[model samples]
Target: MRVFAPLLALGLMASAAHAQCGGPFPAFVKGLKSEAVAAGHKQATVDAFFSGVQQDPKVLKADRAQGVFQKPFIEFSRRLISKQRLDKGRAMAKKYDATFKRIERDYGVSRGVLLAFWAFETDFGGFQGDFNTLNALTTLAHDCRRPELFRPQIFAALTLYEHGDFDPARTTGAWAGEIGMVQMLPRDILINGVDGDGDGHVRLKTSAPDALMSGAKMLSHLGWRAGEPWLQEVTVPADLDWSLTGPGQNLTVADWAKRGVRPREGKLAQGGLPASIILPQGRKGPAFIAYPNFNVYFEWNQSFTYVLTAAYFANRLEGSAIYDAGTPEPGLDGPQMKRLQQKLAARGYDVGKIDGILGAGTRAAVQAEQKRLGLPADAWPTMALLNRL
Candidate 1:
């Protein structure tokens, strides 16, 4: 699941309305109620859904404080794919073998991938969050920064409630209004939900089969190719062109082998499928040959660390060896990243904004600066890079 940044400016703008509508929070909910009715939702259903919904300050706090997004890839992966999570995933796989098989046959998605998402999203159904789905969506939609993204979700949640999928009072999940064991958004639930438990209804919170199969359905719809590996841990030659090591640089296996790229654990077949080299921790750390199917991971979540961690976890569940990267140097924290971005901008690098998100533009600027400074242009930001900047 992707974490969203809170719209503090929007919150400030809505302050006067908040004072007028009993409070900004209540005003926001009231406005959503009017919009819901105008959008063809039954008044009764809307009322019932928002029966006791209130603006949760904690939701805003969680939205604004997404620390995991700023962590280094290895550290994030270690925390996400722990031995406990792996063991529980294996147990769930064994316990629901038949359901997984059925889902695979129907959706052509790997069971391991589904389990990986489930484990990472909510600890394999252990803790799917405690925020009210209605309140969260309403709060987000009322905010201006991502109103376009959350408004539709609010309506989708209302539709689900009207269709008797789950009680609004009981429908709880992440701060971004993601429900179910796999933390699916309300829009995804309305579009890609599936009845995997043969219960004639999709209940993602309780039924493992339902959640897993629903997740599989989502991946399938997102263009997951059957029988294709998402990524392979590979070793890139030291003298290879480091600039080619990132997303969108698709090259065939033969092409990569010609450039001295080889799998760390297995031999690359001649004239193999197209794959992109990904240097998640720069040239000093791990390298991977990401296949075309890897795009499905992005569709699942936009965070590169989250996508790689989920893909690596799924591969591990399928009996692949752990990543063979060396210990990476310490990376920059949020403030350090912002400072680095400022330095790069000072050097006339188009890093977009100094928001400290480490997005593609910032990374590309880093790569350019590294090459200019005669440093290894692996594009991974570190404290060393910041100090030099």
Candidate 2:
């Protein structure tokens, strides 16, 4: 379930109601440079870097795709863990066993979680997003929606250039300016980026270890307990309180036990872990009693469902208990999802495609769908809606 993280003011992208382009680009670019100067960037650094840069509409479009699809919890978990990816991750795990173990030993994050992050972010380092990081971030900064967030990224991307990670021509990544296997933003890289390979300079431009280790460092900073499990897949009480699901609301593991929420596999831990159970599909779906570590994963992307997927994938990579939540409620099944897609398309929605695969695209469509149905379409697809469809 996507518990909206209070609608951040940063990173808002283009919407269907408006299209922004051209003529006003230079003014926007100058605005970012001015803000960068205010934020302690050298004026020349900002000027030379952004003077000739232009807004990338494609990057803006990609940002729009951020939460376009919504999938079943199991399918979303499966989406990032095909057999080949898992095999490659295992191979990396063993090949880099010494390195990863050393990282885990030093940092307290598990090797499996490390590799799962590796797999999740870049598909074992196969397809990091391709875009000029400097140009992309500058464009995003100039776009008016997230100038504050992306402006610093633009400055930092320039810093990466001055530091010799890559010339401007070579540096590129996800439209959001996140590079490498872990998809970190330029600002994140500036603060948390590491030099894992001992290559004199810490660089994510070409080093997987740098990226992976840096990601671990970020997660660790976000409060991942060295040996603590991010979450426990569990059978939440049938009558579990809905009000206490998100952060701030809490329960002791012992209190949860008193309420009969047990670990889906082994014995649930005692009340030491602060936790809450989330019903992603409302009722009749898998439940996870998440801890602080889960919040660490959420720090990467503020989606409850994404956190569950990351933790679940971490479990699969680790040989831990797999969530067996019986059957999903009849929410958005294949055919139903397709119809929703078509409905979205007919209504002039761009949900990537009505391919019947619920993903970021479908989620956007569902949010649009919910708005149409006058439902609280935070874009979470549950099984009950499937039967109704």
Candidate 3:
């Protein structure tokens, strides 16, 4: 890993870029001021919030690099469940069980999942990013790629500043402008911020209780079910079509069992809880039937590993009986993955680029190829499939 850049340099470079870009930013700021004024923010509120903002080239680069928005699920998961990570998660769970329990009681989100998100987002609050929060949000807003998303964050940050929820000058966070242990964006800070510590102020930056509680609050709002695990790894009866794993269908646990789907961890009772199956890395990798709560993780980050990692980390934290049972599939690395992408595209797969990333688009193309070859249509791109490529 490369050494991190100095946060102050990042702060300065960002502010200068936007002020000098001269791309109707004045109009954007004017429109923003009008919006704030219309929303009942005082003139001082708009001026104080947007005062030092500037376009940031670095943030633009980061935004551009997020193109196609997908990564292999397993590959993303390994880093999350590493031994060090698991050990840390366990410690956090045990040390903060009471906190987790409180959140669970109030929000229906288990301590495990909440703690898991806590561990993953900021290493259990070990290091929140160090950019001036307003500057970072403004930088991200100036980024053209996804301005719609980041612009609201800019507004949200300003609102938070106006309301005194955070002092924009003192607050620092990720380049993407997420704050606290769970990396909450400014909008989430607006809507989902909760005073878990009951300090009369929902301070996500310094208060662990506030951050964790707010994190769980976000999950709860997204449909967390009390006492239900997100979903379980299951054994599908031989000959079941594995390709039917994704977000579209919801099957009852019992309904799945009847169709030859059984929890890999022995027989689960016939509770007809709605579920969806996700087959990441295709049929060759592990599969899971996701429950309603699983979708909550998706709300935070729309990646398979992100959702499953939160769940698996939660299980680890909770001392749940099972964690990840999925075996590591040998998938190609950057160069080899690009080679495979090129070959697939040449063979009419229509993968967008020869980038080594096996995003959903690449996975879909891989699935199409497997279907044509009469292989499992699960769309898992592994070395096994790559050999054929």
Residue-by-residue lDDT tens digits, candidate 3, 1-389: 00111111210122222332225766767766666666667888778777776655665565456522245665566655677877887787777777778887887777777777777778878888777777666665555544555656666777677677877678887777788888888777777789877778888878888888888877676667777778567655547675565665677777777787767665564467788767765544666778777776666775545666667667656554543445646666777788779889888877776767665567778877777777777766767677787
What is model 2's C-alpha RMSD? 7.0
Residues 246-315 of candidate 1 have per-residue lDDT tens digits of 8877788899999999888766644678888888878878888888888888877878888888888988
The prediction achieving the highest lDDT against the true structure is 1
Which residue pairs overlap in candidate 3's backbone? 18-55, 281-380, 282-380, 338-356
lDDT of each: 0.79, 0.66, 0.68
Stronger candidate by TM-score (1 vs 2): 1
Question: Can you give the TM-score per candidate against the true fold?
Answer: 0.89, 0.76, 0.81
Among all windows of 10 consecutive residues in model 2, the one with the lowest summed lDDT is 1-10
Clashing pairs in 1: 18-23, 18-24
Tell me the RMSD of model 1 versus the true structure: 4.9
- RMSD of every prediction: 4.9, 7.0, 6.6
Please report the TM-score between candidate 2 and the true structure: 0.76
Ranking by TM-score: 1, 3, 2
Model 2, residue 72: C-alpha shift (Å): 2.9
Candidate 3 least-lDDT 10 residues: 1-10
